[model samples]
Target: MARRMVIIGGGAAGIGAAGAAKAAAPSAEVIVYTAFEDVGYSPCGIPYVHGKEIPDFTSLFLAEKQAYADAGIDVRYETTVLGFDPESRTVQVEGEGPSGYDALIIATGFDYKPPGVPGEDLGGLYYVKNIRRAMEWDKILDNVRHAVVVEASPLGLEMVTALAHRGIDTHVIDPHPWALGELCDPDIVAPVQESWAEMGVTTHWDTRLLGFTGDREGHVRTVATTDGELPAELVVVATHKVANNALAVAAGLRTGSTGGLVVDDHMRTSAPHVWAAGDVCEIPHGVGGLPLQGLTGSHAYAQGKVAGTNAAGGERAYQPVYVPWGMVAGTWMIGGAALGEVAATALGVPHVVGKATGISRARYFPGVRPVTVKLLAEPRTLRLIGAQMVGGEGIKERADFLALAVRKGITLHDLASMENVYSPPIGALNEPIVTAAQAGVST
Candidate 1:
């Protein structure tokens, strides 16, 4: 008999696992169960849909139900996996029918936590974490004339841009002193705040939302913050996310200190014959050994591939090699443990270097924006340990290259002598990465 593998959560990770498993074991039966109505829709594109940058929300779906069926994968929609049984090696699924499997893969992804404030459950409050919420937001935003977003992360910034683009009076509130507080230094963040102002997104920095006030209809009317109350027709909370590991925890699967499912290099959970991937699993960072800040489609696909291949009698380990790239409006931000003062503090390393801002392309380039680059290195050794960049367009890619260089322990002198492609329209004759390395060397 052919091996039967059951995968939960029909998002990017699950889909990739199903496809990869089928390829590894041609005779095996692969099944996918999803709680959502649509499978393989890009969760990252929710903000673009809100911003009306994408013409239609449906365009984000990489695969439909029919596509999965055509690929010989059984896709069970609206089906929820209640829990897993390690001894029986079966998953208890809810809705429609029950099933059994020889191997299991969990990829339930992540969930958002709203601010614990009174009247937050009002009708006008919103949180977008999935496709259903995104569609619901699209419908309600047609009637919303003003909106307030609480948080200043990339998602919060995206929400601000989306509301402002629709001509809605938008206000962004965050308790942090600046937007993307942990991702970029204060020097780099100042210009980003200016860009937000230019885009007409009002910001309330260093202010926390106390509660919400609702009308008789249970619709939010005003948000009460530590500073003052602001009138709002809609409220969006873009706070941090909690991993969806309830099933894993219930099944006695090991989880990380950070609450994500703990898996091995091969993506296998503590339970034999069971594996986990995507946002639910705490994967390694690209540069340092630190856990990734969050999950992305690229990581999910890679993790799923390794998990499925190993489960199919093949030996494969998931080796992560890329950092996450976050884009808000036109601005790009990349995060990784590139030996900055903050990162060195987190890793308990003594490092110091100077930071600089320059153009990725020539100053004459029409669309060029200031790129802030911070370099971290051992003062005595002069070895580059980390680097971070924030700007528009090509900045994220440049930051990624720097992250790799740091991971390889590239020296400041080697980096300063590095070669890069340059064009007046594309990049500067002296790349910011090299320039930043030279700056560190001089320091």
Candidate 2:
């Protein structure tokens, strides 16, 4: 009998899993089910689209339905999987009926979460996470002269930049003093705030949104926050998302502390033949073994591969999750892990931070952007635990090196002694990582 593989969700994770499963067992019948019209589109690019960096909404997609069919995989679009019976190994799809499966892969990612405040259901409120934002937001986005964005995540700042670029009076509000709160340290944050001010982005630090008020037409007009009320035409909320785990919870799968499905390295759930991936599952943190949500697109695809491969009778394990991320907002660019003094204090780890700035190119070379590097190390062992930076470019790549160092438990001395490839047109001869490493060791 041919094995049957059923995948729920058509996001990056689900798509990656589907491909891997088919490759692992060509004779197996593979099916991918999603409730969305478009499949394999990048969610991370939504902010860029809203910012007008992307040319069109259609450009975000990776493949079309024909491509999936040509590969001998079944893609059931606009299909919602409501429930599954583990005993019968069957899944019930909306309007399509129930189907039996030998193995099940659940990649139903994050849900659209609202900022738990009053009057959130009002009109003119937009969410960057929703797919409809890309397909339909254009009709109303033109009228948004003044936009109030409520969020604490780094993506919120991205939205602030996108909205500000559209010549809208953009105001970003959060209860925290700095944006990218846990990711970037104060050293990187200071320059960011100054840049935000220069970009005409009003920052409402240490303020929380209490409620929202609208005009007679029921369109959101006034932003009533803890600080005060401000006039607004539109409100965009880009807050953190909760995992979509209703199916897993109903199916009696064990959930981790991260509020996502608990899975081993192979991404297998508590059930005998069930697997979960993407934001709906939790992976271990690189620094500490604590299970944390792997919310990035890169993570979703990679983890999905592991889950799918294993479910298809192949052995593959997911890797430790670390974010080698960068964001360009307006004229400001930020890179690195953003875990420095604050993270160490919160985690109760005795740590020291070393900071240094190196030019992106030689002094004589043109386009010499300043790259800042902050290295966090254990005071006792001098092991690199985290790093943060703010630079024009070529910084996040350097942060990836540090991320590897953190993964390998590399010592500061080891990093400082490593040879840094430097060219006059690219960066300083010394390299910021080695400089930061030396500084961290001395501290």
Candidate 3:
């Protein structure tokens, strides 16, 4: 009998795992089980489609079912895996009988974090976790006049902008002191916050949702927030997500402290012939090897490759995660990597901060954009631990450089001394990083 590989979930991670496993072991039969209808589509683009940035909902889909078939992979849609038998190396599906596999991969993804309050099950309550749920928003947005989003992450801001663009009188309620509180520092987010009113969005900071009231039809009508009641026709819970570890936990696999599957560096679970990856995973971060979740498609895809390769009788180690994430909010861009001051402090590290503000291009250049750079360092060793940037067109490349620097433990002075290119039409004469590092050195 040929080797058989079964993968759970059909998101980016599962799809990548299917393809990689097939490629690594050509003779093996690869099967992917997904509860969702679509696979390999970008979840990050869900907001853009809702905001009408994209033409239609179908545009977000990556490929059709035939595409997977052509690649010699079987994708089972709307199929739920109920149980796993480690001794038999098989999985129990909803309708189908036990499917034997030589190896199993669990890329079960994540579920939306819901507000712990009553009436959340009401008709108007929605969530923006995956593209499938986002599609429902486009269909139902026509009837919504007032929409309230609960949370203040990048996705929350994006949903706020989308609802505002639709003239829905959007209001955002966040427990954080400021907007995009997790990604950018308050100083970097000030200008963006000030522009909320102009964009027709209301900002409610340091506020929590108490509960919700529904009409006779059980549709959310009034939102009960800490400050006061707001008339709301629609409510979106655009908050963080927890791992989708139902199948993993049921299979008696070990879980991490962070509530993700405890996988080895190669993405192997404790169960025999089983591997796990994607948003359902906890990965190593920094030199400390601390387990953290970097909820980006890039991270999922990379981890899936390792899981698939190893499941197919190949050896591949997962690299230490230097997660680089960013978002474009209105006209401003925010990005970060590794340990920020908040994370470092929680980790009990003695840390210092460095900050610099400059223009993206030469002072005299046309279309010069404002840039802010902040670096976090270990005071004793002077090692760059984290970098955050809020600025214009050029912030991403600079953030990427700093991410690598943090990964390699480069010192602030070393970065300042490194050679950089500058041009009148291209970039600033003095790199923003040099100034930020110089600021770090001064501390």
| Candidate numbers sorted by lDDT from highest down | 3, 2, 1
Window of ten residues with lowest summed lDDT in model 2: 130-139
1-443: candidate 2 lDDT, tens digit per residue = 99999999888899999999989998889999888876788878887887889877778878877999988789998888899888789999888678999999999998756677778878888876556566577556777888888864767878888887787888888888788776667678677678778878888889988988887888899899888887888888877767899998998888988789988999999988999999998888777776777468888999889988999999998777656777786576877752567777888878887888887778688787887888888888888888888887786687677777788888889988989777897767888888888887777
What does the lDDT read for residue 435 in candidate 3? 89
Candidate 2, superposed: residue stretches over 4 Å from native: 130-132
- Candidate that beats the other on lDDT, 1 or 3, i.e. the better one: 3
Select the stronger candidate by lDDT from 1 and 2. Answer: 2
Clashing pairs for model 2 are 183-338, 360-426
Residue 156's lDDT within candidate 1 is 82
Q: Estimate TM-scores for all models.
A: 0.93, 0.96, 0.95
Q: How many backbone clashes does every candidate have?
A: 2, 2, 0
Cα lDDT, all candidates: 0.78, 0.82, 0.83
For residues 5-86, could you state the per-residue lDDT of candidate 1 as single tens digits?
Answer: 9998887888888888988998899988888887888877888888898978888989667988888888988877888798
RMSD of each: 2.2, 1.6, 1.7
Best by lDDT: 3
